[model samples]
Target chain A: MGIIKLCGMAGLIITGWLVGFKKSADLRFRVQRLKKLYEETEELLHRLQYEGLERDRLLLSSFSDFCLVWNGKILFNESGLTAEDAVILKEMIQKLGTGNLETEEKRLLYVLERLRQQESAAQKIAVTNGKIYQTLGTCAGIMICIFLL
Target chain B: MKEDALDAVLPFVHQSIGRVFLFLPEETKREVCELRLRRNLPVCLTLPQGIRYLFKDGTIDDRPREGVLICTAEQLEETFFLLCKRSVYAHAEELREGYLSLPNGCRAGVCGRVAPDGMVRDITSLNLRIARAVEGCADSVVSAEDGGGILIAGPPSSGKTTVLRDTVRQLSKNKRVVVIDSRGEISGGTERPLSLGVNTDVLLIRNKAKGTEMALRTMFPQTIALDETGTAEELKGVEESFHAGVQIVTTAHIGEKRELLERKITRHLLASGAISTVALLSGKIGEPPEIFSPEEL
Candidate 1:
């Protein structure tokens, strides 16, 4: 009976650990997607400035996995962005093709700066909170198991 | 082309305004020459007969005070952005040129504050000119194998471009025809390429002069057709093509036959011997054009 109970407790602890790890992984993946978005936006700016490619050509050619472009607008999917981050990104994209080269370059530079800061902040959160969540889940499970005993 | 002419421009307006277009009667839609949107004013459609204000219910009014559909400032701004295809930077050249040559050969004339760099800002109004392909419209004035050049003359909105489009389409059937469609009005756009002809080669360069020169050198076209040949530079290109023995078919804006000599470009155009036949369109849309030799003017 004791062995069976211990095995059940072990399973609970493992489940808790997996749940915590998944959350942390999601946060990490969000950061990676943000980085990708930043790179794609930079490429877009470069093409607009030098190549003068049209909107249809540019949107059709965008290869980002995080963005879904339809009917001349970009929709972010599973972007792991905060409300504020998403709003900022959207504002920049809404005006993406609506300015001259110099204006667009300036606008993109400002957005890139903001994205870099967000990425940095997200990295810091993932480092600190990720470990905390995993430890908390394991500690909570162990305490419950001890109490049951 | 008439059935879808207005439909082609619907995507470029705000959703509310575009929806109104959807409910518009088919007969009215077919005759709509221009769709005008102004800030804080009733949306208007310029038909063949006269300008009519549009309402939200898809009905139109001859009076502005009626419960007409109003084009708000925000709507105009959004419409302008859409017309630019959400990429103002990409359309900077066209915006600077004061118009946008849209898909399906539709054209939008933009009016707004001018930035020093020539880009328009804070757009206040837009005139969306619907493009229609009137097949056989040019049949009366032109033949595919006609020897010398033909120049179409008309007032604004007098179907000069329409006739020229058909002329090119007709000529391309038998001749090695190249259209210097700098504005994309003649051959429509890439999204839905207008049927110029199976043999027509369309060059979308903005500079008619450069486009003509390049077409002459590389395309080896038997006939080169262009629109809005209003400048000496374009005339020079037409003259060059003439010297190469490549026929030049083009258009010019002239209110009357006498004005052909009054305008310096038209005078040079007629005297250059580059153009032999001139087709003068009545200000009316579908009326047959008056064909004349250069001597008649």
Candidate 2:
């Protein structure tokens, strides 16, 4: 009975650790997603500046790995984006092909700058909050085990 | 061909507008020549008979009435972007020229404020011109014996491009033809382009002079065909090709023969001895064009 109890305690602690690790990983994943989005946006700007590809072809070629779904206006399935980030992206897309070269480049640069800020903020949170969540999850499991013992 | 035109244009409009058009009666859809969308104005369809206002339910009337579909600024903007395939920067040249050439030979005439940088901004309206191909339309124009240049003249919407397309298609079958499709209208577009012929080469260059030069140097074309050649630069290109002994088939936006002298380009074109036959089309669509020799003008 004691062995089974110890095993249960160990199992609970591991499940807690796994949950905390998943949360920490999610924060890191969000940051990675933002970085990927930034790289994609940079490529998009380059194509717009030099390639002059049409909208549909441009998106198809540029965002093949972006996991995006464009329905004429809004872009859906933009994973790992916050509501604020989504709004910003939506605005960028709305004005995507509506301006001249200079204007378009300026707009994209502006959006990229904003996204960079968002990414930096996300990175900071991932560093601080990520560790906090993991520590809290592990401590909670230990406290429960101690109370049971 | 009417169905083809609709197919070309319908995809570039707003979803709501496209839905309305899809439900339109076949007869109404067939007669459509141009789809006009103006900011805050009732949607208008230019039919062969006359202009007609569109209702929300896909019905049409001579005058704007209640429930008539109003083309909001958003719709106009969306249509503009869609027509440009969502990349205005890619079509910057065409946008500056106040038009966008769509697939299937259709064209969107854009009206907008011009920025100091020569870019069009604050778009207010879009005129979507439907492209239709009438087979054998150029049969009378393309003569087997005549190896000389031919010039087609007509007013807007008088089927000048249609006839020119047929001329290119028919000529290309027998001879090495190059189409200086500056606007992408002649050969539909670079992607999913319309059939010109087996021996046809398309140059999507905006500058006719440059296109003609490149064609002469590389393509070794027997004939060079272009549409809506009015600019002095285009005239210069034609002159060069004429001197090179390459036949030219092109079109001008002149309604009547009298306008030929009024326009400096037409005057120079007629006197240059480059164009042999001038086919004048009446304002009516599908009417037989009146053909005359350059001397007859």
Candidate 3:
């Protein structure tokens, strides 16, 4: 009777161990999938931004007036744009119309630089979220093992 | 004279002369007259203010300065009409009918009241195009010549005629330049040219005519210079000139070199080896002209 009880307890321990290992493996797979999705979304966003910049450049070169009006409307509609940014954009459009092409191009480069900074901040947030998700998955797996034991 | 008298006379002068130079003070009038005469503009006779009543009934019989008014199209149909009753010979109509050249080589530009066949006859509205003759405008074309037909292309107000005139001046230095002055804009010669080269011969086809025929037969110029060539027949005239071994220089309304090539007449001229070089004038007068050659393409 004593040996049988001891085997039964060992069998329960082994089953719990296997379940935790499976949960960890499942989480690892899920994390890999999430990472892939995030990468694709990030790449798509980058491409969108690149295309936007190119469009802005071409518009500025050909129809500077249209570009000014369009940029004003975009900045006004976008919630993330600050009052300072709006002012800068207005001044940039004015300068672009009255000043040389080189000056206008420099202003566009400045806008690209600001966009890059925003993108970097977003990347940092994404990385933090990824780590948090990984930690939560591990903790959940450990808790499942404890409960089963 | 009375202020009302001066007021009454001012509109007549504006209508008859297409400009109101008499309203200016003596010193100002002297300066204006000198400038106009120097530029070969039609001379206006100074009139007493009382003569205003004579022009009121459309009776151009009462001679003020010059019997004709040299006002812009805007002035004649609008503010100036209140001063005089409508006459049978509306100066604006005469302009649209394609006669009556204004001083300064400007023909009164007319619009409104098109004929059923889409002809712009009977102009109810007028815009007096102020044509200023800029000497030495065609100087660039003379130096860059390779003895082929030349085209002066530009958007409106980009000084196409000014460049063509200067070219005539330069071409006249060596070659005899026969100018087909369709609108009198090129030479600004009312009866005769006030200023241009001594050697340059001008055939004032003052109103619209067949440019190529006019150039070939009447003028028979060794090198022909004219403004705004647009028709296939005109292109044929140019081809005829080429066949006759006469060099031609003319202006056309266009923006780019590619556009010139795309135009039927210009393209024909290019493809047929009639035009060897095209000088593209970019920008207005007073600014240094930018000349584009075919090699620069």
Q: Residue B277 error for model 2, in Å?
A: 1.0
Candidate 1's C-alpha runs over 4 A off are A5-20, A51-60, A71-74, B143-146
Please state the error at residue B38 of candidate 3 in Å: 30
Candidate 2 chain B, poorest ten consecutive residues by summed lDDT = B1-10
TM-score of each: 0.91, 0.90, 0.46
For B1-297, candidate 1 gives per-residue lDDT tens digits of: 434878878988999899887788888888899999999989999988899999888998788875799999999999998888777887888889899888889999999999999999998889999998889999988753258999899999999888998888888778999999888998897778888988889998889999999999999999999999988899999999999999989999888889999999989988999888888898885688888888876
Q: For candidate 1, what is the DockQ? A: 0.71
Q: Which ten residues in a row have the lowest lDDT in candidate 1 chain A?
A: A59-68
**Candidates sorted by TM-score, best first:** 1, 2, 3
- Where does candidate 2 stray beyond 4 Å? A70-75, A78-87, B57-59, B65-67
Ranked by DockQ, the better of candidates 1 and 3 is: 1
lDDT for A74 (candidate 2):
40
Task: Give me the candidate number with maximum DockQ.
Answer: 2
The DockQ-derived docking category for candidate 3 is incorrect
lDDT of 3 by residue, B1-297 (tens): 322222322342344442434344543222121111101223333232212212222233234454443434554444323221221122333434544345556444445555553334433444334444556666666777888888787877577877888877777777777887876778876543535576778777633236556667766677888788777766777778888888888888887667876777767666766676677766533555556555454
Looking at model 1, give its docking quality level.
Answer: medium
lDDT of 1 by residue, A1-149 (tens): 97999898998788778877888887787788778877877787777677877665665565355466776666666467778777876787666777788988999899889889888988998898888888887877787777877
